[model samples]
Target: MKNIILSATLLAMSAGAALADAHSVVRMGTEGAYPPYNFINDDGEVDGFERVLGDELCARAELTCEWVLNDWDSIIPNLTSGNYDTIIAGMSITDERDEVIDFTQNYIPPASSLFVALSEDADLEGGVIAAQTNTIQAGYIAETGATLLEFATPDETVAAVRNGEADAVFADGDFLLPIANEDADLMVVGDPVQLGGGVGMGLRETDTELREAFNAAIQSMKDDGTLNALIIEWFGEEAATF
Candidate 1:
C-alpha cells in the first residue's frame, strides 16, 4: 500500500530503533491480508508474490530470515520497536516515511490508485469514500472534496462500500482490480490517481548494512530478468517492472 505523510505519532515512532545482530535470524514483517502481495494461504503459511520474492532476496543476501505477521497500521512502529528486522509488505516508498525509516530500491514500480464503488457512476470526487487508515489514498481523500471514511484494514474499506456506509473505496489498483472482477456488484470509477514513489522493503534507519544487502539482491534480480518475471507471474504481464 502507498504511504502517508508522517503525523506526530509517526514521528515519535521513529525516534528509537532497536539494534539487531548482523548474524542472527532476520525477521521479515508483513500484513498477510493483501493478495498477490502477501497473504495467509489455506495451509496457514504466508504465501504470495512478496513471500516468494523475499525468500529469493534472503538467499541472495546470504541472510537467514523468517516471516512475521503484522497489522499494516502498526507495522512501522513494530519495526522501530525491534519486533521485526524489515517490512516486506506492499509498502510504498514516500518522503515522509523516509524521514522515519530506510528503504531499499523499489521492487514494484509506481502504480495507479483507483476507486471502486457499487456503480460506475459513483461520485468519486464528492461522495463518501473509504480507504485504509494512514495510507496515501486516505490522505488524498481528506484533502479532496470527498467525505473520507477511515478503516483499520483494506477489507473493511471494501465492506463499507458494500454495506452502504461508503459510496466508494479508494486504494491501490493492483489490490482493487481483482475484487471488482470477482464481485459483479462492484466496478472501478474515476480516472486513476498515481501516488507514492513505489513499493519497497522498509528497514529501520540504523539497519544500513541490512538495507544494502537487500539492495544488492534486488539489483541482481533486476539485472538477470528474474524480478520482471516474478512481477508478471503475480501481477500479470502488464505489471510495471524495472
Candidate 2:
C-alpha cells in the first residue's frame, strides 16, 4: 500500500513538471520605438502591427510568447544568444542579413523609399540620401548619385533631416508615411526605391522547427480573414504588398 501511494505522488509531480515545461515561454524582441511596427504607446504597452502579428503567430504555434523591447542594432545578437527565440520587428530579408540570421519566408513586403522635408531647401534635386546603417534602403539610394549616410536607426535619420543635420532620409515607405503624416514639417516625396526581397520574421539558425511553425501560422492567418482584417484595422486600408 505504501508503494502504491509513492508511485501516485511521483506521477503527479512528473505531470506537473511536464505541464510547466510545455508552456515554457518563447520570448520575442523588437525595437520598441519604431512606429507603425513596434512602439511603446503612451500607456506603456508595446503595440503595433508587428506586435499583433507576432501574438497571432505564437497562438497558432500553440506557444506562450513574451514581448521584449530593445534597441534595433542589438536585437539579432540577443536572439543569437538565446535571449529570445524570435524577432518580429520590421526586418527585411536581404542576403547580407541572411548571412548572419535565418529568416522564415518573407512575411511583410516593404517598398523601399526616400522622404525629405517639403522645405524649399529640400534638395532631393537628385543627390545623396541617408538611411539606417546596413539597410537595403541605403544601398538603393546610393545608386542614385546620392551619398548615403548610414545612421543607426530611423529615429536618428529623421532627427537628422528634421534638424537640418541631413538632407533627406530613406527607409521603408509605409513606416515613413506615418511619421511624415504626423509631422507637417516633413514630407515623403520622389518615387520609392524597390528592393527585390521581402521582410521576414527572424529566428536563429538552430531554430528550424520554430521557423517552420511561424511560417505555417502566418500562412494560416493569411488564408483566413484574420490577416486581412488586422491589416485594414491598423493601416486603415490595406497592408503594403511587395
Candidate 3:
C-alpha cells in the first residue's frame, strides 16, 4: 500500500512539472459568447475568429494553447492575475486598455456598426442602441444620447433588439454582419463607421515571449491571406482597415 501511494505521488509530480514547463498550453482566454468572433458552438467548442487566430498563433509559436471562456469586463483582471496569457475575444484595442495590459498586432480591423431588427417601425437614426459595457461602441451610445443600455454580452444586446427590448445594437460592424445574416429580421441599419481600430491577442505586461509570438503570427497570417479568408467567410466580405 505504501509503495502504491509513493508511485502516485511521483506520477502527480511529473504531470505537474510538465504542465508548469509548458504553461502556454493553459494560457488562453476568450469571451466564448461573441459569435463569429469567439463563441461556444453547438458542439460545445469555443471557436470563431479569435479562436482560430489564437490557434494559428500558438502553432506558429510552437506552443500548445488552451482556451477558456471569460467575460469581457473581467478579462483584463484575469490576465493581470496570470490566469491567462492572452485574450482573443472580439476585444477592440483602445488606449484605455493599453494602460492595463499589452496587446499584440491587430488581428481584426474595427468598424463602427449598429444592428436593428428589420421591422418597419425600426428607426435607429435616433433611437436607443445598446452596446456591451466598456466597449468603444459604448461611447457612441453615450454621444448619440440614443437611450444607451448596458448589456454584459453581445448576445444579450442582440436579443434586446430582436425582441424590441431595444431599438438597435452598436458593436463591431463585421461581428454584427454574421449575426444579421443568421437573423432574417435583423439588418445593419447604416453604413459602417470606419475608424482606427484593431483587435489583438491581449497579453500581460510581462509576458513578452507570448506577446511576440502572437504579433509575429498575426502579421504572417495577414500576409498569407489566412486572415482575409476567415474574414470573408465570417463577414461575407473582405475585411478592411490595417
Top candidate on TM-score is 1
Model 2 C-alpha RMSD to native: 9.3
Candidate 2, residues 89-191, lDDT tens digits: the string is: 8888888778889997766755556566656456664654668876677777666766777787788888888777778887877678778888888887766
- Candidate 1 residues lying further than 4 Å off, grouped into runs, are 1-21
Compared with the true structure, what per-residue lDDT tens digits does model 3 show for residues 1-242? 55554453444344434444646375688888877787888899997777776777666555677877778879889889977777888777888889898888787776556555666466666777778987888876687747888898888888888777788787877768767877788877765665446777778888765566566566666666677887777666656634
What is the Cα root-mean-square deviation between model 1 and the actual structure?
A: 8.5
Instruction: Give Cα distance to truth, residue 206, candidate 3, Å.
Output: 1.6
In order, candidate lDDTs are 0.87, 0.73, 0.72
Question: How close is every model to the real structure, measured as TM-score?
Answer: 0.90, 0.82, 0.82
Write the candidate numbers in order of decreasing TM-score: 1, 2, 3
Error of 2 at 190 (Å): 1.6
Report per-prediction Cα RMSD to one decimal: 8.5, 9.3, 10.3
Residue 8 in candidate 3, Cα distance off native in Å: 44
